[model samples]
Target: MSIEHLRARASICALTLISSLTLASGCSDDGGAEESESTDESGESESTDESESTDESESTDETESTDETDTTDGTEETDTGNLSCEPEGDVTISYSIEVGALDEPPSVDLDLACTLAEIDTDGVTQVLILDCPELENVAVIDIAVSPDMSLPLVGGEAISMRYILEGPWWFNTYLRLDVEGTGHLLTLIDGDSLLPPEEFEFTSPVELTAVYDLCEPVSDGCGQRERLALMTTIAGEEAQIFDANYAEVGGEEGTEIWVGAAGHLHEIECTDTPDEWFQVLIVGPGEG
Candidate 1:
């Protein structure tokens, strides 16, 4: 009876042990599968983040490249159009003496001819009177002239001349040949001058610059009052010649005058030099 009982008990215990071992192994397999799934999900999230960062970097680089192209185009626009001054209208000159002198070829342009007046007025004084309605100045240009003329007033080839602005207003100025020899139209500047007149030399070439300053008037011996005027130098050197005076008192602007020899003149409108220079032209007559 004791041997049979011991054998049965041992067999039942062995079966129970086998079932417990099987259950523990199944639980371990489930935990390992969950850990593998968690690792795969973390790797996928990191890949997505890397892709988005690369896309943002490319977009930023493209935006920076576009701004560099626009800055280069703005520099080329300022070179060619420096001075745009031109004659506003028909600029003419007249004299107080006889109309017999043949002003045939002396004119504003190189090829254009002058107006020849054939009137035989019997006047004792032979003065070159400048009457420009546009310029608004009734100034005398020349004190004496031959009833007969002998030279052609040419531009870019006239005689050089300089003048000192005498009297308060540009009422009077002294003139002479700019070069050593005479008998030529001394101060005919044909074109507009360059800007920023500082450090400029008034040489043989017809170039004028400007400076902003004050002007005052003067009274002559005959009790005549001259207006405040503009003064310029020859090649930015010696001898400041009086060019123009304020047309009216307390006026902010004035008419520009180009003083050429034999009283050849041209007047243009100019604004008040409020701060920077507003293109003031200082020219004189040279040998023609």
Candidate 2:
């Protein structure tokens, strides 16, 4: 069971407390992602296209040449790449933004505006900028947040495209994702459209079997029962939580959870599990 298909190339940044974005725009790899062949369990197909490197340590110091000028802080580095995901604390709420590329067609810079509380949260979280090789395709066009939010966006060539933010009551928008050319494997659609991803596959590390359970008791409703789950086994399917440990989980079994280096595979649940004797271990997301 060697089923790879998890992009996520790192190089994620989105620092925009509330303002400061000056795009210059330009990107082109034409419309990539039309080459696939990754089969290993001994079936042999190999040829995933090869080109993975989002370069994100907090990257800054443009290079790909477009019209180079700024020396470092002189202000004039145009290859067009400015990311902003803000909304972690002091949240006022209300959002609206839409900007497309790759021929370009989705537009709506900001339409709805503030005020809504019942339970609509997840302001913004999906950033990775600076390396916009002029941007051949950078679209998040129509950012509407209010009771409907489900963002994922990670790294270039579309690593984790998961967007669904219905609007109406609070809006603030700005989205541009084109981290250095080669077609951004885009997909963030539910109402307004945007789709691109014909193929993509890459996976190499395998060896799993991790289970842990202790949830159930929010008066039985199990709101998330304290939280402390960590299942595993990706590709073979049926057992994937990756990581979640709110705090006390006693006796820790082996314990070693980093969950990074591009291995994302989330699928957590908590409706009930008072404990029926479950605590198997043997996890790995480390030792890259």
Best by lDDT: 2
Winning candidate number (TM-score) = 2
TM-score between candidate 1 and the true structure? 0.19
How badly does each model clash, as a count of residue pairs? 26, 20
Compared with the true structure, what per-residue lDDT tens digits does model 2 show for residues 84-198? Answer: 2111111111222221221211112211211111122235422222122232222222222212233333332322222222111101112222212332222211110011111
Candidate 2 residue 257 C-alpha distance from true site, Å: 4.5
Judged by lDDT against the true structure, how good is candidate 1?
0.18
Per-prediction CA RMSD (Å) = 44.9, 23.4
Count of clashes in candidate 1: 26
